[model samples]
Target chain A: MADRRYTKTHEWVTVDGKTVTVGITDYAQSQLGDVVFLELPSPGRTLGVRESFGVVESVKAASDLYSPVAGKVSAVNEKLSAKPELVNSDPYGDGWIMKLELTGELPPDLLDEAEYKKVTEAGAH
Target chain B: MVDFGGWELPQQYTSIRNEHLAVRKVAGLFDISHMGRLVVEGPGAEASLQWLMTNDLAPLAPGHAMYTLMCKEDGGAIDDLVVYRESKDRFLVVVNAANRAKDTAWMQEHLAGSATIEDHTKDMSLIAFQGPRAHELLPKGSSKTDDIPYFGFRAGKVAGESALISRTGYTGEDGFELFVDSGGVGEVWDAILAAGKAQGVLPAGLGARDATRLEAALRLYGNDMDETVNPYEAGLGWTVKLGKPDFIGRDALAKVKAEGARRSLVGMRTEPGSIPRHGAAVSHDGHHVGTVTSGTHSFFLGHPIALAMVEGPSFRVGERVTIEVRGREAPADVVKLPFYRGSARSAVAPAKP
Candidate 1:
């Protein structure tokens, strides 16, 4: 629970015991503009690391939401149905998309906070 | 970059939603330099336009502009344009960006008189300043909103440079579209930005322009209507004048007018807040009738809106329709066109000399 890692696709995953909470990064949310509709995975869905699990539709286009960790979906963000803007207002906080029960240990390819900054800086250009 | 009429342009500078809200709440400046401006000047200028355009141009006095469509011989639209009667022998036509080359060529080949046709798009830069506070933020000069009425334009000084200013826009808000020399266009843009900064003005991109125009139900050239789409079926029958003596596609249009079109443009709104995308299938009851031409989240309205060209069985307002949004048939209602209208151009007086 004390450490969180990010994916090259901008999804952030926080691992605590066998469960992990996943959501898009603040940088990703800002770039996405306003979040209007979220296609979330079902609670029973299972995903492999780096798999595209859902889509986030904004005012302009729909972007794929990728999973950073291999896990089975435990819960989805239900409030986004009425208030998807929460993703824009607070991406890492209230906008968290799903909770997943880990299928195995957290992936070793995940980037830490400082390493994630380097990836996003490259994307800024 | 998005391909808008062959021009690669940024779809959004910051964010589409932010840019949309910026124009609604404050002011937004758009680079519309890609739009074509053609000048027709000579003794037969009026006659040439009268024969080409569908709208009644004979009634247009000097310094007046009217929106019209130039249809093909088959009654399909060539382009939707605005014709300005600058003088008895002088006229200016503003055409969509994508159709500039085709429209210019079509008009030139059709001219059978002493009129001179000129394509001024390359030499000129078109900038649109739009929003609720546009009037207050526009640079002070002869092109002031108080002087130019809606759809009216005049050659005046803008930002210390000679420019043509028109009280016109597609955003349905109060605004001015200025045409400046291509070289000095950046200067005019910078000047307006500096003047309107305190008023919350933004250098908007195509993202905001699309949203704003869609809110007003203004049609996009390629998306809303194209060469394959007739003006009447596109819900732009108002621009076509059937009694205009003899114009391009007049006979075909007259016949089509008598026989109702099999398909028509209509607005669709979805429930559960699913935003439809372009090319999504549209259905009635359980049968597929049409496909969505343009669909997006109306940031200003806090809901989703779609423009669909559906088959006959003409949908009345409030009738339920389903759209296949993202592989699933989503429920939507066939609402009236123009899901939202702002207070911009709606507040201007009739354009006059």
Candidate 2:
């Protein structure tokens, strides 16, 4: 299994060599209600850590999608544009938003699965 | 849950799609207590309301209600409301929840004659049971639910609690809106849910309500029209009675009628799965013409529908327009106001087809 790290903003990133797969967490998808549309960044673009790279639109509202680490967009998820509900059904698998070529080492602030759970629980109320 | 005008309410109980389909195919119940309800009464209540609203309430007899608008002096809408002629001396006005204080103050500022307005929103609990099966699912209350005429209301006991049951709804479905005292709504709600379970009725939330209303082409106050939008521009010209005596925006609306509305709300449908959202730009032949006022994916229709405020009356039904969706211009065809018609419209008779 890939070791995944999470962000307070609900994005999850998994590193495999120099490439990383990024997607929103299940908790994030649930909170967004129904995912209707997504505007993802195109390949070849570079993003800084914590920078907004795209948008996720639910019927309730549109929220910004942020980058967890500095990286160059390697590939975009074309599947999401046609089936946005995949984010709700399978946020981790086929719902994976993008892949990136890491520009540097992993950020120090990324939370492991257990730490992310604690963060979500603390804010659940 | 989302904070809607300071009220924390769930966007959906289960899924937006499931809740929406439940309302269209079977039955659905909604807690609409967040809407503002006000009562205006006194010796000159009718006359005062006549001057306050765009609709000619002079012909509104007791037990009936009329959808109307309160406009500013500039002909822009203050709020769209339903005025209930409860009695010869009393009228009930229901406004949008977010516009409660603003609408109250506007009405009070125009206060005149022997009329007095009272806000009962905080003390009332309102529930809507809608769909083809709504009549069968909801408690009959104290009156025959079938006998109540469209836009008519009756005062009675429902689930052993005194309620005001009205034959009206926002879902474009034949249904009733039950108004009961806040303290006793629990019993009424329980009764309706228990009675509805057999019909596959679901306790719907705001998301389903939005889908149903939009499918009906019912204009939402803040989303489709606001203080800057006049009734005519919002496709609600029929509600304005120019023949009535001088009202708040009569002069301005009369002028607007002659000059014509600069923008008009039109309904449009895109191919299935392509949802247009509010603030999305609408273009005609490569020229930016309007913006999507309200848009949603209709789970029942299996496609996305939208109401856009396009420029002028030049845009005709069947006219093709393009809406910007997720940075791409997508095709949309202009259609008539309502995308779908349900039991409420056909309940009285059979279809010829």
Candidate 3:
């Protein structure tokens, strides 16, 4: 597994070769409460860095899911259609939202584990 | 946590889904101190309130409570509240937290005769214990709660602390809402949780409270009705008493009742994953007809449900409607109010002619 990188918006990405896996951090899922539904882009759709790719609907509210890096959508977690709660239970594993075929160099602004910790800490209050 | 009516409150103690199910299957405790509490007392208390509230309070004897609406002269609802008749000279009016200040002023401005109103919300603590097993699991140290009929309240002792226990709740379940001194409420709260811990009584929060109330089809103030929405249009016509000789909005409400309200509140259901949200547009045959007021995913019902304020004639049960979800229109069905029924002793507010 590669080192996980994060965005200030609370999404996390892990890059391996040319494929990058994306999911929201544990803190993000906790703040969102239960995950009820998610609308994701179909395969082959290209996404721009920082662009909103889809929506995540919880019981309390709906939030937009932002792309952390520019890439072509390769796959989405089809299981979420039937079992969205996985996002709350295992956000980093089976709850992985989508895999992106890296289109350009990973965004320079993506924070490493240590820097993302500071961002989450500042938001916790 | 979220800011609700100037109060910093948690949306859920844990997960909203767990807490919501706890209230339906076992029991859930909620700290609802944010709701406003007012005491109206004087020789003219009854007469004064009867004229201000839309519901006829003549039949509400001491120890009983009734749900009512306070309206403007134009028939728009100012607020919806529960009036508890403590006695012929004293009454307790509980109003929504967000409208506390406005309601307090309205009551004072409309004061008639010798009645005086005092705001008691800041000094009292309110807690709600609700579910099928709530009655059996409550920590009633010295209070005789068994005889307290639905909507009835009495001064009593719970967990050795003096409190006013009312048999009422927003959730569609048998429950009690306890009014205790702010200083002593912690003891009572702890005692109930300790006594019911083994029985699955969870401390719920605003999220669970909102979900359960929506499932019960209880109209939420501001969301379902406001100063611009009249009682008849909000499906709360039953709370209005046109027969009353004179009241603030009696004449206007009577007109709406006779001429028929232009819009009506109705329940709609959608498939899983297509949850409708507040302010979403509702249409039939591609024509805009309404907007969603309150909506959520009913975990117990395994589907999404909503309340919409629709224009023109009311839709019949099973009629088809489409709601805008995520920028696209999704098909929905006009279903019955209260998508599901729980163990509530009686309907919160019955629809009567």
Candidate 4:
């Protein structure tokens, strides 16, 4: 959890050596209630930092899923295609959207946990 | 929370999917106080309403309610509403929240008789208790609810508070809509939840309400029809009684009916993960034909459904169409209105125009 970094757009990222995993934060999922379907990028697709990779559709509206770090998609959570509600039930565990083979240094704007808490608090109002 | 028609209301209390399934399988309670309620009464109430509404009010006796539409002179719908005949000289007209001010002003400007209208929205609260098990789960000892037929209402007491209990709902389910004093509504809300908890009744919100109503093929005023869309085109021609002597839009509506509506509303279904949205383009054979008015992933039906208003000839059932979803055209099947039938008991079913 401490290694996890967040973006202002509410995506979270964590690095294990050069593999960076990404997913939407709990706050983001809470705001977009009852996710019904997600259009996820396929493995082997390249993405740039802060670039939209796919869409997340909820009952209320559709939202874009952005990449936190630049790299080629190594894997997509295929489970999400079948059980999109996982994004709401367990946002961090089974809901991790994709993993990237890191292509460059981590972005400088990623916020740490404590800093991300402030961002969520600011948005709560 | 979302700002809906100037009211801050929850889109869903917990989850839209859960609340929707609860209504289909058990029961769900909804706080619909934001809808506008008006009281019309006097010696000329019936005649005044008869001239204002498109539906024939003479057939709707006391204790019954009828769905009607108010249209502009050009036949475009101003709002769709329900008129409840409380008695010979009293009526309750429930209008959409967004169109409340406009509807009130229109009625006041066109009021031609001794009938008087009063805005009772702020003075009372409206709640919908709906589902298959609603009658069994309704709070015990409520008077006069046993024999209230579909679309019929009775003045009764719920949770020790005097309320108007109506056997009506937007969802295609057997349910009751309660009109209670605002001061006492909280108690009534709590009592129903506490009594029905064991039966898995959840306090639903706007999201579930919209989804269930869409499945029922009930039109949402602002989304499905507006001042530019006429009743005949919105699959609501049934609400327009051409036989009625004279109404505001009767001439225009009759003309449209005789000439036939240029566009028609049709239901379509798509595969899972391809949710159609409002304003999405609908096409046939690569030719643009229509736009989606309402759509959602139906958990109960295990697929996505959409209502589209299309041009040219109406598509036959089983015909294929394409709807733009997230910038791409997806194949969908033209289905019948009301993707699914629920437990509602009604005299007339919504028909395809």
Candidate 5:
């Protein structure tokens, strides 16, 4: 099982072995209502922690995608372009945004799924 | 709920997609109390309006309403409003919420008669029940007694409260816009909700409103047209009565119509995956033409659509063009206005195919 963490901006990162999958939290998707378009970063791009990786556009507004862990972008979610609603329907599973190859030690502030749930329940997102 | 023009109005009481589909499939109710209503009454009302508006109001009979453009002397659109002729000497001007105070001040400064201008917005709450089932949901005896027809109105009661129901709406649907006293708004809303509950009436909000209006190609005041754009250029040339005896911006509109405005409103449909957005640059053959004013993924139409005001040499229908989405320019085709028509009564009464 992957260990999950979240950012105040509503991004989530799941560390599975050496790869970290990043995506917007379910709370973010609910607030956005519908995800119409997703602009993803290309695979193999190097990114620092908290760096903006892409943009998610809803019918009403556009929001930036941020990286929770610093590393090289190993893979991008190609399915989002044709069906961005997947981000809304499944924000934590198949809707994962990008897979980053962890370059160094994982940060400590990354909350567990239980902690993420607590943060979300507190209505921070 | 979303903050629209500083008003914390619901985006949808339930779900936007569901509410939108309900309006298309059945009916949807909207709490549009945020819209502003101004009353112009007294003997000088006619002359005062004639000088402030572009439509030929002198011809509008009592109980009639006309969608008009309130413009500056330079012909720039101040706001698009619905002027309801309550009588020869009294009128109801419905302005966009964001422009209410500003519009009132502008009209007050241009007053030419003993007509008293009063802002009835805060005192009155506006609600709209729109869809194919609009008439089916409204209280009995609510539909016009006479041939009020589309774009017309009549004073009547809804849910046992004094109301002014008009056959007007932002959605291109068979609808009624009700004006009721603010204090009784909550009760009226509950009554209508209960009355239409069996018919799948949802309390729609700003999200559903935007989608329906966009599908109809109805120009939003702050987005599609503004003080910098004239009515003629915003695909409202029909509303401009050049022969009107006299009105503000009449000369500027005539000149613009004659010489052709710099840009004209046009509709564009992009490839399935790329949806253009507001402020996105519009282009043709690699040259910037205009900008996208409003764009959305029409859930009913199942495609990404947009409305743009492109410069002269507008692309003909079916002619391919390009619109910059994100950073890359994507292929789009120019099309006639109105991307989708609803199941409204007006649309149901087919106009010779």
Candidate 6:
């Protein structure tokens, strides 16, 4: 969890060496209740930092999933197409949206766990 | 929680999907106290209401109810409401909460010689016990809750509280709406919840309510139609009794009837992955046809459904249409009104759809 970085848009990325895993934070999933569907970029798509890579849809709304770091898409979680509710039930683990292999620089504005928690807490009110 | 017409209410108590399924398979309770409850009584009650409303209440004997609309002189909707004939000289008019003030002023301004109007909205608590299992959950004293026919009300004691149990609901299910004193509402609400908890009855909220009503294709006043929309175009032409001698909007409605609607309300269905939100644009073959009036991801029906006011005489059933969802034109099929039906259809009533 300490390795995870978050964007103001509510997406989180965990970088381990050259490969990074991406998903929405638990706070994001709670705000968008009952995820029903997801649209993820397939392997080989190049994404710049902060670019919209896909979409996450819940019963309440549809939000764009932005990339926190510049990278080339390596894989998308196929588990989501069969069960999107994972985004609501286990947003940080099984709900992980995609994995990317780093190709470009990481966004400097990405927040660490403590910083992201502060951002989400401020929005709760 | 959100403020709905000055009443604080949650969009979903548990979850919209779970609460919606409870109403479909078991039961769900809702606090519908926001709806305006007005009592009109006196010798002229029947005649005055008949003149103001589109439905002729002449044959509406006491103990019966009729769904009708009140319109402006231009035939645009004032409000869609249900009038319950309680007795020969008294009637109860339930109207939309947002239109309470407007409806009251309109009714009073057009008041006739004998009848009087009283707003009981602040004095009464309205609870909807809706679902297929609704009848099984009501308090079992006199067992009168089971006897009230659809749209019919019976004054009785429920959970030891004086109540008027009416077999009616906005959900497309067999249900009873209980009207009780506002001060003692919590007692009755708790009693009903305790009784039905074992059967998966949930305290539902606005989210589930909106979804169920959309599946049934019941029009919401402000969303589906308003002061500028007429009955013929809002898919409620059946509630207009043009045969009646005279009403506030009779002349204009007659003209519309003779000429036919240029744009009419129609139902549209999309796949499971996408939802049609309100105010989304509806298009056909790259041309903007109309706009979505009301829409939701129907948790019970398992498909996203919508009601749109499209250019009529052209948008027929089975025609493929498109809705702009998230900046993309999502494909949808134009279907019949009432994306689904339930036990409420079993009761004898005016034609639906």
Q: What fraction of the true interface contacts does model 6 reproduce?
A: 0.33
Error of model 1, residue B190, in angstroms: 1.6
Clashes of 4: 0
**Per-residue C-alpha lDDT of model 3 across residues B169-281, encoded as one tens digit per residue:** 99988889999999999999999999999988999998889889999999999899999999999999999988875889998999999999999999999988789999999
What's the lDDT for candidate 4? Answer: 0.91
Q: Look at candidate 6 and give me any clashing residue pairs.
A: none
Clashing pairs in 1: B173-B344, B173-B345, B174-B344
Cα lDDT for residue A85, candidate 4: 95
lDDT of 4 by residue, B96-169 (tens): 99999999999887776788999999998999999988887878656756588889999999878999999899
Tell me the spans in candidate 5 whose CA falls farther than 4 Å from its real position. Answer: A1-3, A15-21, A39-54, A67-83, A93-105, A112-125, B139-148, B344-353
User: What DockQ score does model 5 reach against the true complex?
Assistant: 0.40
Off by over 4 Å in 4: B346-353
Indicate the TM-score of model 5. Answer: 0.88
**Local distance difference test scores for all models:** 0.85, 0.89, 0.92, 0.91, 0.85, 0.88
The Cα RMSD in angstroms, rounded to one decimal, for candidate 6 relative to the true structure is 2.8
**lDDT digits (tens) for residues B22-139 of candidate 5:** 8888888999988889999999999999899988899899998999998998999999999999999999999998999889999999878798899998898999988888777875
Error of 4 at B251 (Å): 0.9
For residue B166, give model 5's deviation from the true position in Å: 1.2
Where model 3 places Cα greater than 4 Å from the true spot, the runs are A43-48, A70-74, A121-125, B140-142, B346-353
- Give the Cα error of residue B101 in candidate 2, in Å: 1.7
By lDDT, is 2 or 4 better?
4
Measure candidate 1: CA RMSD: 3.2
lDDT tens digits, residue span B1-353, model 6: 77888888888886788898999889899999999999999998888999899988999878878999999999999999999999998999999999999999999988787899999999998999899887877755525654567888878888888888888899999988888999988998988888889889999999889889999999999999999999999988999998886999889999999999888999999987778888999999999999999888876777799999888757888999899999989999999878899878574455559
**Docking verdict class for candidate 4:** high
Q: After the best TM-score superposition of candidate 4, give how far the Cα of residue B73 lies from its true spot, in angstroms.
A: 1.6
What TM-score does each of the candidates earn? Answer: 0.90, 0.86, 0.94, 0.96, 0.88, 0.94
> How do all the candidates rank in terms of lDDT, highest first?
3, 4, 2, 6, 1, 5
